[model samples]
Target: MTASLTPLPLQGHVLFRSSDLDEARARVAEVFCPHRLDTSGGGAFAARHHHLAGQGLSLNYIEYGARTRIMPGELGAFYLLQIPLAGGASIRNGAQGYLSTPDRAAILNPHLPTVMEWEEGTRQILVQISRAAMQAHLAAHLGGPSDRPLTFDGPLDLTAGPGAALRRLVLWLVAEADAGQSPVAAPAAGLMAGQIEKTVLSGLLDAAAHDHMAALGRRRAAPRPRHLRLAESYIEAHLDQPITLEDVAEAAGISPRGLQLAFRQHRGTTPLGFWREVRLARAHADLLTAAPGVTVTQVALRWGFTHFGRFSELYRARYGLSPRDTLRAAQGG
Candidate 1:
């Protein structure tokens, strides 16, 4: 069957559509990473890719109307969650191997080598999430950096529990896009897009089996100390202003030294570090909802971030996009 005859998802957002093998490989590579694509069985090739690019991730609908093998060694910068909508695909990510279907999905870790073979008539919805954004989310959960790279134990079960919820969430995003209500497609939808992106990332971490589950559980089980709560409240209130450690310490009714000790013990970071994280988060939100004529400098300055270069670097590390890019996206540029 040719791609034109196939009922495709995200129909209005066509990134690439072609029957030429080389052209298909090159065009798809522009959106994803470089990969080798070849016909594995004696079948005709027809390819279509429909895509929606958002703040920290993208939603894609792809189909190759032939039996094909794809070898993309080490994704390097992003994770891919692929849910087959029509036919199944055999996926091998590093030492793990599985068959992905409608009831079962596959998440490809950025650090692992992957090889996949799609059956003829296979079509799928793929979520590409930035590695930096994912790592930052994980760090927020763990309260510190992970000792090793995060890896999921797949294939993800999409029938019930968190997996089912994740599947629904992804599909909902697609539905919204198709209906012209997607934050991804709307100008000035940054805050909404950021929230959706964060929700999806968080849901993926919760649904999929991963390396940091135990640590995450432990962090959640631990109760927040009274002083820490007070300090956090103070930080939130002062995010738009320049506040020092002494101010937070005083608000929490603890000495600066004691506040530092408590933060290190319970939060796995310094008091200043926690404050910086909160400030960065606020800056992100501001950028996402920024109006036309608002500049990255204005957002950073309003958020108490004085160092422009440093703020941009940290913002990219946390949200996987530069501050200017986020602002431009919010302004519908």
Candidate 2:
């Protein structure tokens, strides 16, 4: 579908900038901290921002001054991603503190009170994506809750591995927005924003999973398409063979969790869910056109539906019709 966006001023809606520390601090207060600010009356301040919000997702790109004071209790509302473009920042979340530098990015979930202090003469690329957006993406792709903000604390070192491509894409996106020549047309821009939101989310989840793997002393090798295809084909060939996730994992010579992960990465669906859908689709086709004398029970059994009543119920639920109704409609056609 074609996409579109509600255009907003970068400085006002998506980005805020002011040389006057007071003005800058005031701007921060409008969204995060709603109180008076203490800053020099006059200073050289500049800021730029651009963003696209689409399909319950928001992607904001912002660059601001090198040194800025983040108020306390300001991070209790939104989940923010801070990517250093030129300098660095020291962030303190109560007792937990970390340094965010140009080579590294820090993710902050605003549920906890925290403060940020940007380094002097530094520039950063900030992407403010919303939680709802992450959830939507998860629903579409992974079929689960996308709760919890993920923090990857270190130099993304995107210069190597799978992260490199993403890093380059981010840089390009920032540049296009700044140049006023973003090829992302209105709707396309919105779509791109959504994709970026999902990509970031997937990265964070994958990183978390990687951390878990590390804890388990498991190192993941690069995934191979052939391996995924072998696993999928195995499932398809044995759809009615009384299968278990463990069996599939064994056939593929991987752990059950690893099998699940592979299926998610390759097919964007759980292995068993995909198998059930396949069976249901086949049953649907058979019900639609299986000769004049075919019965609903026969179609169901042929598709590995062991329980006639349950099959009929599930069939009706999935296709909005009983198997008999589907046959009748097909004959009428």
Q: Say which candidate scores most in TM-score.
A: 1
lDDT of each: 0.85, 0.55
Positional deviation of residue 100's Cα in model 2 after best superposition, in angstroms: 1.3
Model 2 C-alpha lDDT per residue in residues 1-333, reported as the tens digit of each score: 001112322322354545565666566555444533332223344544445443433345444444456655535334556666566777765455778776566666544556677665455555554433443344344322112232334334444554555556555655555556543334556456555556766665443222222312222333445656677788778766568888778877788898888666544556676677567767877876778778878887777889988877766545445777778877774
Error of 2 at 18 (Å): 2.5
Error of 1 at 321 (Å): 13
lDDT for each residue of candidate 1 in 83-148, tens digit (9 for 90 to 100): 988789999999999999989999998888999999998889999988767877887887654435
Model 2 RMSD, rounded to 1 decimal: 13.3
Clashing pairs in 1: none
- Tell me the RMSD of model 1 versus the true structure: 6.0
Misplaced by over 4 Å in model 1 are 1-7, 186-188, 224-333
Please report how far candidate 1 places residue 302 from its true position, in Å.
23
Q: Which of the numbered candidates is closest to the native, going by highest lDDT?
A: 1
